[model samples]
Target chain A: MGSVVMHNVVSVDGFIADADDEVGPLFEWYGNGDVEIGAGCTVSKTSAAYVQPMWADLGVLVIGRHLFDLTNGWEGSPPAGEHVVVVSHRPRPEGWHPEASYFFVDDVARAVAKAGELAGDRTVGVAAGDVGGQALALGLVDEVAMDVVPVVFGSGKRYFGPVDSQHLLEDPHVVVQGDRVLHLRYKVRR
Target chain B: MGSVVMHNVVSVDGFIADADDEVGPLFEWYGNGDVEIGAGCTVSKTSAAYVQPMWADLGVLVIGRHLFDLTNGWEGSPPAGEHVVVVSHRPRPEGWHPEASYFFVDDVARAVAKAGELAGDRTVGVAAGDVGGQALALGLVDEVAMDVVPVVFGSGKRYFGPVDSQHLLEDPHVVVQGDRVLHLRYKVRR
Candidate 1:
């Protein structure tokens, strides 16, 4: 019913976050799109227009329990959309949080299924991390998108979950998002 | 003195080589400048001119022992230059097979020092893997360069080596290498 897409910003070395779990700066390119980056660096205007449509078109978001906990249940407004599903081994929290709407599912397949039901014909965006990798391994993900940041974390959480076997991705749509950020979009070959 | 730079082509998922240790197809974009990548994907001409200077500027290449063994001592010619240093814990092999100039060193610092000596005022490039990561961790690497290929290996060897802590990098020189490859250059902040 809907496509499942995984998206996130990662360093050139594929670190999604630093050891301290700082992801705010990896997304700094989003706030400043017209700054001079470094020598031999140039931003393409085509890359600048990628974000807005992505947010508007996303009808559902499926994330992991860890991400849900890290953001404190998104404090009500998760970046993706109004309908959010968190894949968690634990049951739903007892307290009511008015900040965001979240559906807790124990597994990735169920999360995708629930997200598709909630999204209708729209797209279901899979939040980054181990959840995304699980989706990829399960052949439930349709696309993988990333804003490849210029920073090198040297250590931290990787965007790709460790898959035992190889999973080939179709050639990506590569574009310079900002002066230093590269936006890469790939269709997962199921 | 010479700058020690680490360079490699990696899939968007951060895989440098496949499980079988094959790196040929990950670099296919360098040969085919124009081809339909995947759905809605096309090669950009601006991304085509990124190879020559990278190879010409390298003076010495510092690689790991595993890579040296994999190539059987680079058979004929190493990609970076004639003068190469291999970082290994084992003893030097007996007799040369007439390929490239190779120096075996046990430590990362020694390899960098040797490469610097051999390179003169030129740059010493570090082949990706344990050697590159070791250089980065030791604060000996000056630059980190990568050709971000559009494919996803899902599983394979990563470009980074295990470090005790995180190493942050400065703003990078970003350019489109070829139709589907993005060349990223980062100056390591020592």
Candidate 2:
């Protein structure tokens, strides 16, 4: 069996961006500098310490059209390590990453299934917070890790909603730094 | 100047609910009880434990149509202790609440401003998850607390969205838990 993992930065007030659709400020908060805190551990070394390694492990990447546009140039695109799937009605643009094999799917489920199928024995990383929540709601995500930022977007879009009522979380693990940021993890239960 | 607070429950995966609008199911995860545990400092026997006398100071309640219906008090209306503001496009029903004042405003801003005015020296409570999140995004809520349920609602409406990213938490001043519910308190920065 294969699984998808989603990681995101959410505002303290439960928003991802402001009303202006800008998440740059939130990104800037984590982009200060990378520092190696201890053995195999680092704090704020490049946006997030966990993202780079997590992204590296993924054999497949599933992203939404909006997220695709946000990264511009397929973002860390896994450097020839991961195949990418994009869900969009829009046509692919010219001069896209050739190393990255891109497929346009019409729905979230198809996009997810394709990622799982392509992932083979490896893990599939679902990137967008919104879509990631949707995948979790659909019982597709196997695990989730969130590096929750302490800033409130003040107005934009929220990551999740008041959805179904029967879903459950197995164990909640977290590393808290007294309000600076929290890296939380949860296992999805069916 | 006014500040808003967020009280909520998120899955270890950081989901407020599943894909369905099922808050009731989320509550069952706390081990079958309604109140999870005691949190923060309690002001009264009738109030949530996390809520202090400061929250009770807010004398008004603001909510959306969905919540008003969900609570199912179309006939008796809100109690006399607090003035209730319902944000909806429909016309206000004649003599909606026998013991309290009911103002139905289409615009969110108006509803908020009027609530502030009516609340006078007291605080204003933005009711329901959806409307509560909206008010927080608009920078309307001053102090808030939520009964965080454990269920992972499968598929319906979500309480917050990436769209709700307008604001983030300033500091998590408190965390309280009951057997089936949790109470989280977050401050909104101006």
Q: What is the interface RMSD of each candidate, in Å?
A: 2.9, 5.1
In the range B1-190, model 1's lDDT, one tens digit per residue, is 8677888888776778876888856766655656333322234555434555566778988888898898877674766676888899886677666455888899999999999999998889997777888788878888988887766676678787665465666766655546556677888766
Candidate 1 wrong stretches, greater than 4 Å = A30-48, A98-100, B18-20, B30-48, B98-100, B177-180
User: Model 1 chain A: which ten-residue window has the lowest total lDDT?
Assistant: A35-44
Candidate 2 structure quality by residue, lDDT tens digits, B59-87:
66677776566664444444322577888
Measured with C-alpha atoms, the lDDT of residue A165 in candidate 1 is 57
The native-contact fraction of candidate 2 is: 0.61
In angstroms, the error of model 1 at A61 is 0.9
Q: Please compute and give the TM-score of the first chain of candidate 2 against the native first chain.
A: 0.77
* DockQ scores for all predicted structures: 0.45, 0.31
Model 1 chain B worst lDDT run, 10 consecutive residues: B35-44
Candidate 2 backbone overlaps, count? 61
